[model samples]
Target: MNAQFDIRSDSTQISFEASDNAQLSRLLDEIARNEALPAPAPENVFVGDGDYRAIGLEYLGHFVHIGGLKPTHRVLDIGCGIGRMAVPLTQFLDPKTGTYEGVDPVNEGIEWCVQNIASAHPNFRFCRLDVAHELYNPGGTMAGDQVALPFAGNSFDFIAMVSVATHLPAKEITAYAREVMRLLAPGGRLFLTAFLVDAEDLSRPTARPRFIKGEEDGTWIADPAAPLGAIGFDNGVVQDILKRSGLDIQRVSFGHWRGIGSTHYQDIIIAVKPE
Candidate 1:
């Protein structure tokens, strides 16, 4: 019963059970053992508030610094849950030259990260802010709401938001886009993912409902089609919002889970601040 993370860059977020690959499973188990990560926590069935969010976050973190992180760069992990990106990031960071910050709306997520991992490390910081890549906890924050960031502008060098925009509505996406601009440092990079498409090709819709009516504010929420959250992105509208926020789109890539099919492909976006 080890808690480890086994992730390779080429691997996508596809279902592991379906593959039935013994070697991959053993690889994952080995990685888990090294990290002391608990046994596979039934990520396929994300239930309740503490679904396998941590698992996804961990995997995303694995991808964030996939190739490698520079020695002096700082990292901001938005929607950072548990110690997914937060914990693994420590390995890549230089400790003195590098800094790490994580934000999460769920207090428990932030609390767990801070207590179990961040607090003990002086160079590392964590807050309960929910803002993504925004200037909330410039010194390693982990709290932010739908709107409003507490950090000064251009506070981070590198920020990664793993599947944060996947569950947001248009307005929410707009908010995240604006915040991303404010939080990124000049020449900084922001890596994130979305479940929706911005380009209206008549093939893709803005949203396909996924929640029971009145689930929260009687709002028609996106159907929880995916295990983690909602899916789909607005048609380039998010990129436009970033323009107004003074941010520019650097690159966009489409990714598909192993067996999830085209409908669930993630829109990988990399936005950069003006150098």
Candidate 2:
């Protein structure tokens, strides 16, 4: 391969165009081969292989349909555990103009993505943040609220954080919202999934209160014994945080976590930076 075509070795950091049928065929074949391979061990990945594929495809479709993800978009996947979303996106995003960058706290998931997804798809990359979460990374040094991501300001066109916010405390959620706003290119969109709780929703007789109130009124925790087991926040407070961060809410779709019989299990929020 010539200098212009040399993207396989450090493909995790590079992007290339599949300008011809042969190149396109090769790309498709690589994706198919990867899809056939078994996912990382379930214990390490936190989700079953079959479930990963199903949820990944579902999230990808939602990103396309609801978030307006385009072939040319530069995407950032927060909490990209074990390449769940990255697997399906390999076939959707165009190699020439599209890119995927995934960041996660767990080393196992990041390692798997770097070895498999990033190696095969040059336009896709993964990074491990080593962020400290009592449940996920007990030994981590960095805190999600304080750590800055490796990306430049105003860079990504689309950002997705599926189930990520559900695991973050209120302060971390605010910090991430601010960081995401800073990293979003003008007009860029963000898609996030969480267990949203409004005042009325919380008051409902059927409400099970997955997360009990933490020290902060805005924060909630699933396990009082383990504060980081699962986290949630007041939906109104989160919405206010995003608005304060300069992101306009484009859509809000509640999910079945509230027993409302929605398409997904978590509520989805789509926010966009102003053009």
Candidate 3:
């Protein structure tokens, strides 16, 4: 399915849009034909870690069962690395009604997704955001706070940021929270994961990936030299940010990162914009 799509950009943001319905039909047919293909080997995984296809499948269930994702919802995938979540979603979302927009700072991931995932699913589009991070995009020209995402206000019915906040500082998290609130439609849901620590957890001696640095601003880093490498925020700070962003916190499921038997490695937060 060689569908043509438009890539648009302005000073602050860049976007991809699919304009061909016939291309979508062909893509869906191709997907149906290859539904039984085996998952990729772990050695071939590049963007993050673990088996790429398995991780994507795992998160797809999380999105549907925990985040209330619908087949027809318009989704905004923040930090969509190499189409991990998008790949599994193609099987679930309705081609005619559901749409996906992914944004990430990593150029390679975005480029790979455009070539691999977007070509197979026209409704799935990817964009690169040139935002700076200590680990991911050091050469990025813009700070996370300064970025104005290209999408219109209240555009997406669901917004996801899996494993994203764990790498961002307090200021960037706040900025992204506001952006999520702005981009989400009224009553839309926001699903994200982060490393969360409470005062009691901090005092414990056996805390996993002990965050011993930068507790002044409710943000802690496992490594002081590389603050963005692995970060944990105080639970209260996360609550405050979402509340200030005008999102109502619905649930926060603590993950196994702190040595508890949870469903994931990072805390899952579900919030909804008020109607």
The prediction achieving the highest lDDT against the true structure is 3
- Write down the RMSD of all candidates, one decimal each: 9.8, 6.7, 9.2
**Selected candidate, larger TM-score, 1 vs 2:** 2
Give lDDT per model, in order.
0.54, 0.76, 0.77
Q: Summarize candidate 2's per-residue lDDT along 1-275 as a digit string, tens digits.
A: 41123222223322334343354345444544454544666666674235666677677667866787766789999889889888878776877778999998888888899998888788999999888887778799888789678889999999998878777777788888998999999999999987777656655655544556777777777678866656677777777778988999999988776656677777889999999
List runs of model 1 lying over 4 Å from the truth: 1-33, 36-69, 130-146, 198-228, 257-265
- On the 0 to 100 scale, the lDDT of residue 90 in model 1 is 49
Encode model 1's per-residue lDDT on 1-275: one tens digit a residue: 32223232123222222123463444444444454432223442221233343454445333433412343567777777566565544443555666777766656666666776665566667777644432223343432236755677888888877767655555666776677778878888877776434323223333233223324331332443432255454446556656776777877665442122342245566778898
Q: Which wins on lDDT, candidate 1 or candidate 3?
A: 3
Error of 1 at 223 (Å): 1.9
What TM-score would each prediction reach against the true structure? Answer: 0.63, 0.82, 0.82
lDDT of 3: 0.77
Backbone clashes for every candidate come to 33, 0, 0
Order of the predicted models by TM-score, top scorer first: 3, 2, 1
lDDT of 3 by residue, 133-189 (tens): 878898999997776788999999999999888888777888999999999999999
Better of 2 and 3 by lDDT: 3
User: How much is 240 displaced in model 1, in angstroms?
Assistant: 2.3
